[model samples]
Structure formats: C-alpha cells, structure tokens
Target: MRPPVEVCVFLLSLLAPGVLYTLNNVPALQEPLPILGIGMVVLGSLLLLLLFIVRHKTTLDPLFYVFAEFSFTCLVGLTNALEQDGFISNFMGFYLKKGEPHLSTAYAVMMSYWEGVVHFVLFLTMIRRMFTRKSYRSLGLLWAGSSIAHQLVHVPGVVIGKYGSSLRPAFWRNVPFFLVPFWAAFLLFSRPRETPIVTADKIASEQKKSLLSRPVDLLLSLLLLGAAAFSAFRGFVVLDCPLDTCFTYIYQYEPYLKDPVGFPRVMMLAYLFYALPLLAVMLCGLNTPGCSWMLDWTLFFAGAMAQAQWCHIGASLHSRTPFTYRVPADKWWPVIGLNVLLAAAPALLALRCHARPAYFMKPVPKGEANHKKKKN
Candidate 1:
C-alpha cells in the first residue's frame, strides 16, 4: 500500500517557507490586508487538500488536519526567526509589521525559535508515533502544555501591550492558537492513560523513603522552593510592590518585567498563579506516596517552564527590547542563571517521575496483590 495521505501532506507542506519567501516580493501582498487574505488562502488550500484525500478513501486519524496545518507553521516559524535575526530579510517582515506587530519583540523571536526548532521536532516525533501505532499520550501532553502556555501569554500580551492599538486584520489568525491547545489537551486527557507496570512491593519500598534519603528528590525540592520564591518575588515586582527589594530587583535585575509590551509581566504572574502552586503540589507529591498524578503533571509543567523561560530570556536580552528594559549588564548572569534553573527543575523532576515511576505509583492493596499473583 502507498504511504498515508498525512505523509504526502507533510512533504508538500515543506514548500511553505519557500513559497512565502517568493511571495514577500509580490506587490499585491504588500498591504496589511494581504495577511488576512493569505490566511484565507492557506485555509482554503488545507481544505482542498483534505477534501482531495477524503475523495481518495484514505482514513484520517483524529487531528490529522491539525497536524498538517502545524507542519506548515513549523517551517514558517523557522523563517520568522531567521527574518527577525537579520539572517534572512523580508520573509516575515509583512507579518511582523501588520499581522502581529508584537512578534517584532525580542520575546517573540525567542518564542519563534522554540516553536521552530523544539516544537517542530516534537510535531515530527508525534507524527511518527501516531503512524507507528505507539502510545504518544505523554508527548501529546507536553506539546499541549507548551502550546497552551504560549497562547495564554502571547494573546494577552498583544491585547494589553503597545501593539494593542495597532492590531490588524491578520491578528485574528491567533484564534486557533488559543483554542487548539485546550481542545488537544481535552482530547489527550480523555484518553485512558497507560499505567506503569510495577509491583506493590516496589512502590512501597520507593515511597517509604524520606526526602533526605533520595538525594535527587531533595535537590529538586530545594530548587522548586527557590523557583516558587522567585515566582512570588517577580509577581510582586510586577504588581508594584512597595518593598525596597522588589523595587531594586525590578530596576536593576530584570527591568524587562516592566516593559510596555507586557509579555514578561504576564509570564511572571502566570508562574505565580499556576506554576507556583503546582510546584508546591509536586513537592508534596515528592514526599507523599500514591500521588500518581505527578507523572503526567510534571511533564506538562516541564514543557510550560521550558517555553516560558525561553521566551522570557530571549525578550530580556533581545536588542529589540529597550536598553532600560533589558537586564542590566552587571546582573545578567544572576538573572539568566536563575531562569535557567527554573526551566531545568521541572525537566529534571519530569525525568525522575518517568525514570522510576514506582515511587509515584498507587500502591496495590495486599489482597489485590495476592489475587493478581495467584491469577498469574
């Protein structure tokens, strides 16, 4: 049998960047309205492609069209980052200028890189997993969390930032960015999770250990505490906390939090409201037995942290940001180092949760264990 239609669409979608590059010079698309027109054209093309495949009697897996659409965006993201960095010119200039002007910011550039490089690889891997008939739930959750984090901050940032007044017809294209992740998360979470196979004896033995006994867990707990504290500090800083430390840190350490673009401030608050509490719960999960939720949630948080930190750091240092808002030269390492650690903590925690999941596994009752053993 021939390869699936998805495989063909994937190959065809690689033409997006080149096509866009050629279109950049087209005078017809020079105006702001062309962005909306371009969006419509893309939508039409995708619909046509889908209809063609259906006519050929190919079975489409759930989210087949979504994946096809994202395949095109992956290449576009690379082009966006390249155009922003000046390695390529005019590729996304029109989009940046009128489509979503906020994308010209340093934070958006870094986010573009994440979406281009990291998320592109993830989409490819997920596609491979789907075609291979493997369980991709864990990977799906990671992508969902990361994509949701981007939309949550980005959409709001644009609405409140200086760009809010300048939003063009093309800006509405972000509607899918906001809706798809939540929908994907809903779908992924609704699927029955594949349970980790581990014995009750192993679960008990692992969970019985104290925090001090597990050196890695202890380290992660301390780091989580530090991250939580940092989140609170930044959250306060953004809220105009009257304290001297908050004032000093905002002006001297990370003035990016005060940028009129509003992305950094929103990101800090998100960490405080969502990530901080989750970290506390995860810390508890580290200490408490039978917190099976840690396995998936940890991965989700890791993806969010990774995406948020990447954008935050890039925005903080990007030349596009005003000098006053960028990290002070004297305080660069401390700010970046802390952010790096924040990104790393969740990743390490996720790995630990997956590596030896028995610690987090729900303990089987003695009777249940005996019955299962007898049946075996």
Candidate 2:
C-alpha cells in the first residue's frame, strides 16, 4: 500500500528541487542553490523510504511520524526560503552575482506556508493524543503566549513589507515564539504512557530491585534533560551576548549587514530543539514503526549544520576584503571530511535502528482507526 498524502507531500518537497531542474529552467549546479535543492531531494527520498516501511508493517502511532515530517518539512522550507531570499548572504557568498532575485523564492515560500498548516494540524493531533482537557487548556495558554509573541515579531514584516517599509525587528521578535507548538508537541509526546497494571507493577518492582533497568528509557531521560538545559542556556545566556560579538557578528557590517543573523539562528535553534525531543522519545522506546521520522530530523539538522558551516563560519573566516588569511585551497578537504563524518554518524545509527525489530513495534492509538482502515 502507498503512504498517506502527507507523506507524499513531504517526499515531493525533498525531491522537488532536482525535479524542478528537469521540469523548469535548471539553475547552475555549481552554486549553493542547486546544491541545497539537491540536498532536499535526497533527504526527502530517505524519509519516504522509511515511511514506506512503516506503512507496510508495525502498529506505531502514525500521527507521530506525520507530525515529525510536518516539522521537518517546515524547517527545510524555511531554510530554503531564508537562503533564496538572500538571508544567507550574511554567512555565505552568493553564487549569483548581485542584482537578481533567486528563482526558487516563490517555491520556497509556498512550501513554507504549507509547512505551517501541517505544523498547526500536528499540534492539534498532539494535544488530543497526549493531553487531557485540563492539561490541554494549560497548554493552550502557553500556546497563546507564544503565538502572540510570534505574530508581534512576524506579522509587521508581512504588513510593512507590503507598504515598502522594512520590518526586520518584527521578524527577530517572532523567532522565539515560532516553535512553541513544536516544543509543546515534544513535551506532550515525552510523557510515559499508561501501561497494563500488571506490567506497571512488575516494572516498578524491578526498578526497586535493580539499578540497571530500562536502558533506553534512562538514555532518553538524560537526553531530554540535557536538551532542555541546553535550550535554556542558549535562550537566557548565549543570546545575551551583544549583537557585535555573536558568532555571526561579522555579518552585521555595512555591506553584509543587509542580512541579519537573528532569523537563521531562531529558525535553526527551534528546529534543533524540536528534533532533540523526538529523537529522545524514539530512543526511549517509543516505537517509531519506521525510520522516516529519524530521516526527516537527520536531514533537517544536517542541512542546517551544513549551512552554518558553509555560510556562517566559512563566511566569517573569509570576510576580510580581498579574502586574505587562507591556508592552501587543497585544505578544503579537511572541512569536507569533518562534515561528511558528522552527517554520516547519525544516518548510520538510524539505519542500524531501522534494521532492528525492537524499536519498531509500538501500538497504534485508538483514535487513528480510520487512518488504519484507509491504509489497509
């Protein structure tokens, strides 16, 4: 049987860039735009492969994978949009010479809007699945706060930009709140499900008797805790650094300052935070059924990190006029080697987990009975 429409949409997004080259005017392959386009296509293909596996077998919660894909697609679309819109100039050199709008901007924006709709639907599903009425009500309040902040930061840009005014501050302000639904989804999924009373009692007794218990659960708990700590530190402390001293600070100069680092940082950080929890949950034995969720996140982070290195770090290192202070051009291999290793490790781990049966046996939720019927 084929996967759902949502899964197909995500797969198409990943493949769209390469397909676009064949279908529309192919952009130059040597530039970052083509590279990014190809990267998305590859990532989406990997995810679709995993989704196919889950659809054919296993009983894991389908919505989890759907929601995860939604988050990942949003992230990828946002990344592409930011780059196509010339936001990445602060961190990387453009392949095209000055004075041309990126051909891919419209495609990126359309994908981003669809991503937002999917993301909101995913949030609603999570709320229904994990939260009781009272808990969801509390979560709703938090969502409202984040939504307000997000709009305050982003809506003005949309409004003012229509009137020929710059609203950069609005975009910056919205960053922190943009992922509130994502974070809420993470917290909702992290809670332990209610097991049979007998099984619960047995596990409780085992826990009291032995320190070594539920290795996956232990690791998951630690990861979640660590991610939470890291996020808190980043928000309250790391961002405290003055605008002139941040890692991407060099880009704030007159010529390069046309692009701001705030939006990219916010987008990347939110994606990383959202992904970490899902990874933790899967690692903790949440039966993902397929590797699509894993693949989605792997690509999302890999793409973001690549952009950071190429644009953020690389750009800063060469920001000097006339591009001075270089070792041999041949030394570029070392950086490539490091990136390959970093991207490969998680993908290998995901493949290994996918090959095993222990992690793919989660039961489907009762609410998704119709979805199951449709699949059958």
Candidate 3:
C-alpha cells in the first residue's frame, strides 16, 4: 500500500514553497508577501482537501516532519541567494542587507552562499532519503546544529550593526528560522519512553560487560568530547578578543577574529552557547544506558560544529581578511584537518549511539511489582 495521506500532502507541500517563491519574485507583482500569504492559504486548503479525499486521519509522522524541514530550508535558501545577489525587490534582503554595510562585503557574500549551499544539500538529502537512517540522523544533526549557529551570526550582525535601530522587522522575519530547528530537534528525539521487562538472571548475565567490547564506540565518544572542548575553546577565544582588535590568538595560531558587517564574534558566542550545554548533556549521558536522546543531541551538535567551523574557517580564507592572517602554509593541513575532524566527530558519535543503543539501555528490574513501584 502507498504511504498515508500525510505523506502525499507532504510531497505536495514541498512544491508549493518553490512555487510561492517564484510567484513572489514576478516583476509585475512588485509586492510579493500578500501573494505569498495567499499562496500559503491555498496550500493549506489543498492539504485539507487531500485529507478529505483520502478519508484518513491527519497524522504527524516522521516523513511529514521532514517535509516541514525541507520546505523551510528551500524558502530560506531562496532568500539567502537574493540577499547575496543584492536583489532589492526581495523585501527581506532589501531591509536586512540595506541597513547593514557589511552585507555587501565579500565576507557576507561568502557566508550567505555557504549557508545557502549547506541548506540546499540538506534539502536534497531529506527529500531523496539519500542516506541510511544512521547517515540521515547524522545529516539531520548537522543541519539543526548549523542552522542554530547561522542564526546566531545573523541576529548579532543585524542588531549590533547598522540594523540595530530597526530591530522589529528583522527579528520577526528571522523567527521561523530559529524556531523550526528546535521543534524539529524535539520531534527527532521523541522516541516513546517504555519500560522493558527482563528476568533477574538475564539482567545479571548482560551486566558482565567489557569496557573494550566496542573499541570503535569508546573512540567515537572520546572524539565527540574532544570536539566539544575545541568548540568551547573557540567560542571563548572569539568573545575574549577586543572588539576592534581584528585578530585573536589561541595558542600559537592567529585566525581572523573580526566581526565585519556580519557578527563573527557574535556567531562564535552563539556556537559556544549552544555547543557547550549540549556537549555537557552528551558527556554525562555518554555511558548512560537507554539515553536515546543522546542520538538526537549528537545530530544537533554535528550540524552546529560543522557550520560554526565553516564560518570561522571561511572568514579567515575570504579575501576580506588579510592573506597573511589566513591559515599559514605550515599549519594548513593540520588546521583544516582539525576542523574536518571536529565536524565529523558528531556524525561518527551519532552512528555509534544508534548501533550500540543497547549498550546504553537502562537496566530493567525483575517483577511487575517493582516496575509498578518504580513507575509510581
């Protein structure tokens, strides 16, 4: 049998966003939002109509949630493209970029394109079911984490820079971007909590565990913790630098630390804020049995680290920064490799969590009486 009506509607919903995007940009229709708003209504009506025709209950399945994510990413990707290309007609780009002198600079352009590319890749990956669940979870985490980091860069740049005076519109327009990933993350982690029944003998037999039972699992957990440390360190380094210094040193390395028209400093602050808390949870939960939530958290951090690293590394390499301050030749491979490892660590950790989830499974006590008491 075909998937439920929700799945069909979700498939249809994907097309509507791109169609609305095109309609909004039509030359004769100088004002696009009214039309866009109407388009949303029409799209909603269509989904409702589909539900009626199918005679099926409205269900919020995993694929449906994935559709929501894909649609939003596509819309944002369109706007990012418009902003970077200096399209005055696009209301969001005009207002947000016009106020900020940096939006026009090369660094802003590079960052915008980078975000657009990342979002686009995610869009394709979700729609295509291009990866295994383990791989998909990794991608989802990377997307969620990166999205949160991207907004961090956006908010501080708009508020602290030229757009500071006109905060209301920019803040509201940016709300959905910030909100969606959080909701998605929650949904992704919401595997139902259930108590498993097992005999005392079985539990005892399983408890005879070896630390090295899964060498790869232990290694990934350590790698994730290491990456978390690096992320925290980077954030602190960014914030500690004097606002106008334009460069900061962490140990012997001096990477670009300027905020530019964009909020590189603020972006780092957001990364640190989001990463450290999540990392803490993951570490405490690392050996935690039945901590399926760790899988979701791992995905989220993977995205955050990947995006934050991109912003940091991209800023340094951009022509806007002095070439001398870019990753030095001697440190090129090491620095780039470290960043790559940081991004990869979470993905690997996520796979480990999924594969060996039983390793972390909470021990179930024997007897219904005890289970009921524990529940009570």
Candidate 4:
C-alpha cells in the first residue's frame, strides 16, 4: 500500500487561488471566450493529473475521480464567494461579468458561500473517508442530496430568471455542476448500505414501542407537521397568493421570496412540492415499524435543508439584497426563528434515526429471533 493519490487532489485544491491569480493576470484570458478555454485546459490538466496518480498509488474508485473533480470545483466556488464580497480583486471578475452574471446577486452570493464553504468541506471530508477506508456511504448521501438540490434550483434559476436574456457561452460551463451530482447520487444509492450490528431482541423491543411511547418521536412529529405547513406557506408567498396573510407575510416576513434573481422563489417552491410531502412520509417513518429507509432518506433530507436554510437565511440578510427586500428589522426574530425551526426538524429526525436505529430496523424472522434468544 502506497500513499493515496487523492492527497494530490487536496493539494491542488489549496493551490487554486495562486492558479487563479496567474490566470487573472493574463490580459487575453480576461475575456470570456479565453476564460472558457482556460477552463477546458485546467480540466484537462486535472484529468491528466488524476490519470497519472491512478497509475501510481490509487484505489481508483470511479467515485474517487468524481469527488476529486468536484472538490476542485468547490475551490472555484469559494473563489466566487470571495470575489463577490470584494475581498479578492481580478480573480473572478471577468467570469462574473459574462460567464454567469446572476452570481452577482445576493442569493447567488450566499449560494456561492454555501457551495464554497459547506459543500467544499463536505466533499473534502468524504474524500478523506475514502482515503481512510471508512464507510462514506452516509456522507456521500448527504453530499449528493445537497449537490442535487443546489443544481435543481441554481441551473434553472439562472436560465429562466432576469439573467436569462444575457446568457453567454461561458454559462454552459455549469454542465458538469448540473449533471455530475445526479450521476454520483445514483452510484451512491446503488452501493449497499453499511448497517450497524444489533441484537434481534433490541430490534424487537424498539420496534414494539408505539409512537406515543417515544416522547421524542411524538415531539418531532408535531414539528415536522409545522415545518410542512411553513413550507406550503412560503410557497404560496412566493407564488403571490391572493390571501392577505400571504401578502403580509411576503412583505413583512420574507420579501426576499420575491427577489428578481429567481433563486429564492424556486427554492420556496421546492420546499413546497418536494420537501413538503417528504416531511409527512418522514413522520410515518418515525412511527412505522421496520422503516430502515428512514436512515438514508432522512440523512439526505437533512443535508438539503441545512444547505437550503444556510443560503436562504444568509441571502435574505446579505447587503447585496436590496434593503427593501431584506428581512425587516421589526419582524426579524419571528421570521428567522420560524425558518430555523423548519431547518432543524429534519436534522433532529435524522439524528434520532441514526443515533439509535433499532426501532427502524427490519424485524428478524421468528426462527432467527428464537435462535438468537436461545444463543443469548
């Protein structure tokens, strides 16, 4: 066994800023067309570097390549966040101007921070797990959910929002960002779940308990319902519902939902149609016997909510947002507190399932259960 090839990937990600500085200085490279070409060259260089590392000392899991590439992209995303905040100059300005102008918006700025920071840390952690020969299945599921939710909102939002009219050739560079996560997700879900070992009696006793008996589950059920209701309310607020409550809530509670950038609007609707129903099913998972599915799905849902909430909250308060659209000072606590509650429910539910999963485990066969009892 030799040193892992992925160590190089980590190093390259750290070196990204210097590389961007060098690229930024090239006058010709400042143009969008040249910048796009530079992207291809950089990608090709990374692929060649990967191949070389593979030939030397690599486990060479296909996912290793996917994650390595994605981790590098995280560095780029971080650079975007830095540039958008004016902490860095010349690094991403050219690309920001023509490649993807939507990124200049407050929602996009916050999204860049989430991707650059949260998602970057996640990808790197998963890669480290792979290097250590540990089970990354759960983390992979988390990253997959986060990445897919990001693309589902981001790509479509850019294409259809106010920025749609200024579409440039460099915009297509997001193709991999849009497509690779779905592929990675399919691969991750296909892998066998690495379940924890537990005695049959433990599973039996846990599964035998009703929802009412578990105070935590009962409490979480109520919260999940509240989260679902909030999701629906925000969806209606974004859609410009006729209800006076919706109108007041939009203006006073979350005017960011009406931002021209479109990402916030799409995000609220996603909470409505996709995340809302899942909350109900998740409630069922808490009460139902033998719902092993909850373990994986809840982890996935938790990741999405975490990312979604981080971006939504940050963007809503970010200075880039028009002051009029920003969260009002008078109603800040109620609005932020409600959003925080909804965001926390999935995480609590996931932690509950994963921390002590016996209740959600499949029941052992009667014969097997008897044998285990006798053996014990």
lDDT of 1 by residue, 1-376 (tens): 6676557766766787777777677767767788788777986787687667657645655765676677677778778878888988867766776677777788888988998888777777777777678778898889888998998899988888888888888888889868988998888888887775566787789988988899998999999999899888899999999999999999889899999998988888898899889989999998888898888899888998999998998889999899989999999899999999999999999999999998888888767776776776
> Model 3, residue 294: what's the lDDT?
71
Model 1, CA-based lDDT: 0.83
The residue-by-residue lDDT of candidate 2 on 1-376, one tens digit each, is 6555444445544543343334234335434445445545654665676576456544555434444444444554454445555564321123222111221323224334433454445445443443222233223323333333233323332442232243322133224345544564365445443222222233333334321354643444454455444434333323444544343322322112122323223423442455345445545432233233442333333333333323322332332212322222444565345434433433344444334323332333444534545665
Off by over 4 Å in 3: 1-143, 161-171, 191-214, 241-254, 288-292, 318-330, 364-376
Better by TM-score, candidate 4 or 1: 4
lDDT of 4: 0.84
Q: Tell me the alpha-carbon RMSD of every candidate.
A: 2.4, 14.4, 6.9, 2.3
Candidate 4 lDDT by residue in tens digits, 177-244? 78988898888888898776677878988888888899999999999999999999888888889999
Clash pairs detected, candidate 2 = 14-41, 91-311, 153-170
lDDT of 3 by residue, 1-376 (tens): 7564335544654564455446446544323354445434654666565545455534424444444444544544455545555563443333233223345444455556665566665655664452222234455556767776677776667767654664442244456566777776665556443334444445444345544664676686687678777767767676665544323344335455444444656765665776667767776676555575675666677677666666667666666656655666667777777777877776677666665455455555567546655677
2 against 3, candidate with superior lDDT: 3
Error of 4 at 272 (Å): 1.2
Using TM-score as the measure, which candidate wins? 4
How should the candidates be ordered by TM-score, best one leading?
4, 1, 3, 2
Q: What lDDT would candidate 3 get against the real structure?
A: 0.57
